[model samples]
Target chain A: MVTNEDAARLITAIKTSSTYDFTDYSDKSFCRRIEKILLDNNMDLNQLIHKIGKDKDFLEQMVKDITVNTTELFRNPEMWQTLRYHILPKFKKNRSIFIWHAGCSSGQEIYSMLILLNELGMFDQAKVFATDINTDMLEAAKAGQYKYRFNLGYLDNFDKVIKENPFNFEDKVDVPYEKYFDIDKVKDTIQMKPFLREKAVFRKHDLVKDGNVFYSKFDLIFCRNVIIYFNNKLQSRVIDMFNSSLNRDGYLILGSHESILGASANNFERSKGFYKKKQM
Target chain B: MNDYKAIMIGGSAGSFQVVSRIIAALPANYPLPILMCLHRLKHIRSGFVEALSIKSKLPIIEPHDKEPLKAGRIYLAPANYHMYIELGNRFSLSTEDVVNHSRPSIDLSFFSASYNFKKKLVGIILSGANKDGALGLKSVTDNGGLTIVQDPKECQVPTMTTASMNATKVDYVFSTKQIIDFLLKLA
Candidate 1:
């Protein structure tokens, strides 16, 4: 059993020696991830800490694994509805738009935004910067490929949640199974369309180290469903970064269950799923 | 009225039918709050709340962050998030790693209520494939709260109910109809 003191020491050592910071994340969740990492690497707690103390690659892999990048497209339909109805109207006055999708795992959400923008007829005018620490996921996102099983379900959900007309049968949509995928009958490989491939740029960026990317102010930022892994302090710091990154009156969207209320409540106003930067 | 403050229901696998039946049986004026944690796939769209709401006599909604826990209403767990009650009539949501491979794990909510409500909590464990609610029911019983389990013979999936039976002497081992009657008697 790794004591809290041991975890705290490891966190302190990593912050001073390396760029990653795990000190402020939820203790229970962070400890659980660490336990899993130790089990996967077949290391006892002491050995794992010692290995992390010396090995840079091992440390990087551990940070990436423990980051908790799991998210689904439009995980909460109501939040997206809130964004469409309440938040998007504010952006109508802007001539151009910038969006930063941090921790954009597998790019389903980036594509979801692209589709939303397309529906809003703003896709051509928007520039989206999508980044994640996982290079493999970024590559997959860039390739615009996903398993067929996920696509079937996503298509069903997209039609219901986004299209909002369950009566319009999915078969009526010209989503030529081919348009969305390149299917291999024998090998069972399916490649998805690189949705908004031209308008979006994919990059590998760590939120902990590359904290300065927010220098270019954006009109909207969607960092949904990613912060549950961070400790309270890191959550506060990242919310600060998000606050700073937005231009005046810009919107920040978060996971439905997440709230900046307790930690960063004063910085933004709650509107549906968004926290709008208080006018300076 | 007895201090029947809040009720927590736990189920897995064949829970949808049981949940629907319970909600349908409740009167519109049912005065206590009800919270449910049902195990389902993380990715699939859930119509559990909607389906139940249509059949239910009381108001039903998903719990929002810091949303006050009000009486005369039912709140179902949103898919893929853990829902727990806070100290003072509020809800807390967390994407904390899964326990027993379930995010809206029954154990988390039951344990939280057991600690917070003591005898004021009423726990019911229904149909499930695994023993997710055994420890949770135990927690409720040990904490002086009331515990109920679906009769194994009546359950579509008996593993979870059987586990609860083997682990502790649950207050009630009733069928879905009998469970509704039991709740009505308490109400």
Candidate 2:
């Protein structure tokens, strides 16, 4: 296991050797991830830091390993229901709906959004942008393929959010799963349809250091499940950035379990499963 | 004894009634914050805190990610997430893959709390069907903190307490009544 001092040393080594800075990450989570990495690579903190300082390939791999990338299609069903019934309709009148998926790991969320937009007939009017710090995740997002068995549970989320209208029990839509993606149970793969895969613009962008890389005010920014890894200072900085990046009354949707803390939370009015930028 | 900054309790299976009774016994003015990591059904997000709150004088909460830890309150690990007590006395939640077949793994929570508070912390393990909290209780000892286990002879399920005893030499093997007595002494 890595000690707190060893974690600090590793963070500093990574910062000095690369442009990445983890100074503002939650210390406990960072240390735990490092401990896992150390165990997996069969190296102590000193050896890991030594390789980080010397080998670029090894350093890149280490950085990627440090990032938590477990994501599934429509992970939170209720949040998607809120987006579908309540949030999306509010933006329907707008000619172009700008949606940004910041820290969009593995792109399940972006596809999730696209499927929703297409269902609502708002796809043509939507401009979607996705970004992540991990280039590997970006590539995986582009491929838009996931394990069928592993994500089988989340497929229920798709049905809950898409096919069934919660407001009316009799209002059931017969939308087949193949309409959005192809599933091969024998191969254990779920591949996003080619059109859905190509809809979003994917980029490699770091949330900590980068500032509004898209340079457009978004109507809805989904930074779900991403800010939990950040410390209060970094969370505030990112929240402030999201506050600025959003249009007036724009939505900032986070993971169900995540909420804004500190003074930065003042920028948004809390709604069910999401936050709306408060009008100045 | 009064110098202890926090108390961490890990339990599962038949531990709820034990925890409820302990919390019911604690006064509202209890000084140290109680951190609990109990194995729970991941999909059921609500009602756990409300149920736990029914018997306690202190406020029971499933802490949001990065929420600051406060004294005189019971912080239950939220469903489907790992809760950590960070160095800054704030709570950080993680959706990282499950450990020991549990998302809110007892070992992970105890590890962080023990590291943060060191000798100023007290770790307790209660009735559990699994051995998740064994290494975590050992971590408390490793970091010079006090460790306790509900006496296995008195536990509904003895695996966790037994495993913890085999993992490290705990400071106390208290019954439910004795555990309450130990906490009240701290207050």
Compare the candidates by DockQ and give the number of the best one.
Answer: 2
TM-score of every candidate: 0.75, 0.95
lDDT of each: 0.76, 0.91
Candidate 2 lDDT over A247-272, as tens digits, reads 98799999877998889988899989
Whole-model lDDT, candidate 1?
Answer: 0.76
- Clash tally for model 2: 0
DockQ of each: 0.23, 0.76
The positional error of residue B82 in candidate 1, measured at the CA in angstroms, is 3.3
Spell out the clash pairs found in candidate 2. none
Candidate 1, number of clashes: 4
Candidate 2 residue B184 C-alpha distance from true site, Å: 3.0
Candidate 2, residue A177: lDDT: 92
The C-alpha stretches of model 1 lying farther than 4 A from their native spots are A1-17, A77-94, A133-136, A161-190, A203-214, A231-234, A266-269, B1-8, B13-35, B40-47, B50-61, B64-75, B84-103, B107-123, B135-148, B165-187
Residue B109: error of model 2 in Å?
0.7
